[model samples]
Target: MHNDDLSRFFSENMAVDGELSFQQWEGKVLDFAQRVSRGNCKGLALVSSGGTSVPLEMNAVRFVTNFSTGSRGAGLVEDLVVREWACILLHSESAQLPFRRVMDNMDTERFFTELMAPEKSSAVASIVGTYSKYKTRLLLVPYRTVVDYLYLLRLITVAVCHRAECLRTMPMVLLAAAAVSDYFIPRTLLSEHKISSNDGMTVHFSCVPKVLNVLSDIWHTADCDVSRLFVTFKLETHDEMLETKALKNLTLYNCDLVVANKLQEYKERVVMYWRDTPGSPTVLQRPPNGSIESLIVDCILRRIECDATGGGRS
Candidate 1:
């Protein structure tokens, strides 16, 4: 899409309530990016996770949302921090968080009690210590609706690119792991208040614009002279069409890598199609007691390291 068309798309589809506070959010992102750029780190990773919601009304009592607990994205952040990569995590408001996932299996009552206990458990203390150790390395940005997600994403990406240009030598990676909504009701079309249930309702939705189409252009034109990689994910229900769709997106979106997985086996394995060798993609498998995200992050970091050394894409 051309720049004019992209502008029109955003103007038409991204209108939201005034409560979004995008300026404040943008300031936070800029501050985070600047801090990371000045610090000594391997590279910068902008990791987006969770699902965006489509509000049915301006007041937003009803909405549509994608299915995502953000576990994969959270796990990716944890592994990236371990590798000494500064990360900006953009996730849904209610999604799972990095470091906090260590308590996922604990009962809700026990989890709250442990936090309030005079003596913290080993698990809670460890998690807290890890969080403190890497507090400056990770920036958490949360969004609620699809409008907010897209707006915040663009803002954060621009900030990162700008800061990267200042450093001129840092590598950058855009890891889009969020389960974003494909359809939404524009703000102009949404009901002003909560819809009544007195009668049957019929609603219409408009397709969400493809941001991936323009992301590469943004990175290139933001005065950023650094090694950059763009990675996107594809989740399909039909196993037969998974690779085909992933490859198609890999080419269509100009992505450096497309991680494809079937809905039924997403937690177990994912096939990675690289821009350099789409035909000979790599398949990543989860370990018996480890997360698939850990393997994925390792592969991405290796690619980044290879590119930094003047080696071709991995």
Candidate 2:
């Protein structure tokens, strides 16, 4: 694409809801990128979580959103952080947060009530240590709208892909688990103020372009010899179509792996479609009384470690 075409593509595709917040969040991302450059963090993982919203009006009295709760992605962040990987968690403001889910049950008032309980002591100490050790390593970059999510994702993804090639010695990973919106009311189509129900309504929205293609190309070139392991999730409501859609994404986006699961079985099992492996892919199952986090984390770490050692794509 020519320079003019490239510029026009972005402008017409994603229009921001709040320009100020987008710019402010971008500054934060730049600072994070600078920090990564100077740190000795062995690996860098950018994990996106939650669902994105589309504003119906400029003031946004009403909007559209997906059904994602962000549990899987947030869990992934916790697993990586616990293993000491430098993490950038780009999550929705309403989504689940790493460690906080556990701490939410360990409320401060409830804690003080049982302040000296021996059982609570261990759990309390663990939480304190996790926060203390990971405060500097795990950075949270939250988003509210689809526009904010896309803009921030582009900024961080491009920054990492561009910089990793030049200076990174450790492996980099991009895990996009967000259930992004495929349709949205463009800025030009949105009303300046909320529409009143007195008129009853019909709205026109446009398809939102996916940015995975750009990231894959940016990080895949021979000139950019950055070792990376990219993974994405595919959630399907239809059991029969799960594998088919996952396979399609695995090829279309050129991802290293795609975690495909039906909504009913999402928490219990995830079928992984491998890009490097030839025949069938692996199905990671949670035992009758097991934690799926361990299984998921183990699979990801195995792939990431392989690429890091193999010196490039694995």
Candidate 3:
């Protein structure tokens, strides 16, 4: 991680008129630029998750996948590595760590014991045998809450921008797929203790900071640039009228492309909307009328490639 002082250094050196201080790190920046120009630039893929903690209601059914399984992101990450792209995988909760199928039925405590023994034990062997063989070529940066995700996002974005600029490389692309919580209660409900049957607790709600919009704002304001491509997702539940709502939300975010899907269509999402302008949309690609992860992956990758060519956004 870069030192906090470095941020101050960059801040203090800003141009008198408040523009980017291009000359602040003249010598160092030039050197880095030269190195990048020489084709030594490295590519990066950063995958992150948003915080998810559903508030409980007395005698109410709990929800699963409230945060994420990290399944789709992890799958794409595996594919990216196979294509030789250097990447980083950021996560929020570890409880939902995407486990291999073999571990699905294992006794976790016993498995760990074998993994730590001087020699490999049958328990460990069985666990390993059940696991799928795959290469992980990504830096792991895990965060547990929305604030953590925001902090890491800012730090990495700045560093990535510097590396890209110095090397004269294309702006780094960012994918916004995490199902971030829209709001967070200021106070914990647990501290409130048991509520009276006669008196109902009407908790006040406040909006949480929109991290994606913040990222876009920073990217737009900085002298540093980003990738020719930018992708974001909008998940909704109104299958009959999802496209319009998703497009409206995407426009508000100022993203290049929005991957919108309805909750009801997750099992067989045959309809989606792709819009460069809110008024005009194309039925880009539709999956078969059935459940399919590959279809979702393909659609997203295709849009990613489209933006890579600089066809969308400003």
Candidate 4:
């Protein structure tokens, strides 16, 4: 019989044998497979643009940037793929991760020369070629500015929530990982050439809508349990008082878990407190230096399984 069929059959007959049997072994194997599969999913996803926004004029105008190079976010994406999660990577302008690979013959000279070619656009051609080869079952939403990112996020939020409400079977998990810009410049400044420094510039600044706040509020109204959604927080600071601040923020935000990271240290991490309701903060013993991605994925998956099975400890 096929391996999957055998596993299924064994699962069905697990209760028949009072003593443990190969069926139990099969169950363990399946559990491990599922964990790995969850890490490598090519499923539906909506990733936000990664970068920091810097304020230009004290409180008025600002720069909508596609900065920070997106390395950590890209690494998180790769880790998700390992879990079998399908993702729709929403890439911002000037993102560091190159979604497409270069051609064998590509070089600076070729790239510049191709720009002047009268034939089909090289950019379009490259896209077509890459999509044709990599079975990238993903819907890519490209954005050049912070406004575009916000709009796309809102659109996806509505769609994903609608699906969750309509389809009562599978649960939807949202990971709020993007470093969204907190401010934007006025539309009038988009075309402005130069402003004289003699006259002080004043730009009225407004807060960018928090995507997580929206999600959390709406989902709470829907009466979804906090355990159903996992939110992660990244805090960069000194170890002296980082944990206290991180835990306080977690309590305020009501996230399932907050990974308080200190930039100065290597693999060793000081995880800040946890929920008073279900359990306490888990202290991870000295993890390997280059295993943050794996640790995060494992923690999330474990929590998912725990919640799915009625909050039972595994």
The candidate 1 region of ten consecutive residues with least summed lDDT is 14-23
Across 153-188, the per-residue lDDT of candidate 1 in tens digits comes to 877777767643454577888899999999988778
Per-residue error (Å), model 4, residue 136 = 3.9
Best by lDDT: 1
TM-score for each model: 0.93, 0.86, 0.59, 0.59
- The positional error of residue 218 in candidate 3, measured at the CA in angstroms, is 3.1
**Residue 177 of model 1, lDDT score:** 93
Tell me how candidate 1 scores on lDDT: 0.83
lDDT (tens digit, per residue) of candidate 3 on 168-231: 2444446666777666443333233444458765655445555566566654444533343355
| Candidate 4 per-residue C-alpha lDDT over 1-314 given as tens digits, one digit per residue, 9 for 90 to 100 | 23244334334322334224322333432333344334434333344436655334323244646365554455455555545554445566555443342332368777667667777476658655644543343444455455455444544555444433332233445555566776665443333444456887666655554455555554344434434454554646677467666676566666656666675542455363445432466655446556565566566667666777787643
Backbone N/Cα/C clashes per model: 0, 0, 2, 20
Candidate 2, 196: how far from true, in Å? 0.4
Candidate 4 whole-model C-alpha lDDT, 0 to 1: 0.50
Candidates 1 and 3 compared: the better one by lDDT is 1
Report model 2's TM-score to 2 decimal places. 0.86
lDDT of 2 by residue, 1-314 (tens): 23344345557645454544566765566577667657767677889999999889888899889757788887888778778778889999988888776656566887566566656566667877787777677889898788678777876776666644433565677888998998887777788897998987988888776777666665554243446777888888997698788888878888888888888888998888888772487888888866675687788787767665675533
Top TM-score prediction, candidate number: 1
Worst 10 residues of 4 by lDDT: 13-22
Off by over 4 Å in 4: 1-46, 52-66, 98-137, 164-168, 186-204, 209-211, 220-227, 265-279, 283-290, 311-314
Model 3 Cα shift for residue 308 (angstroms): 6.1
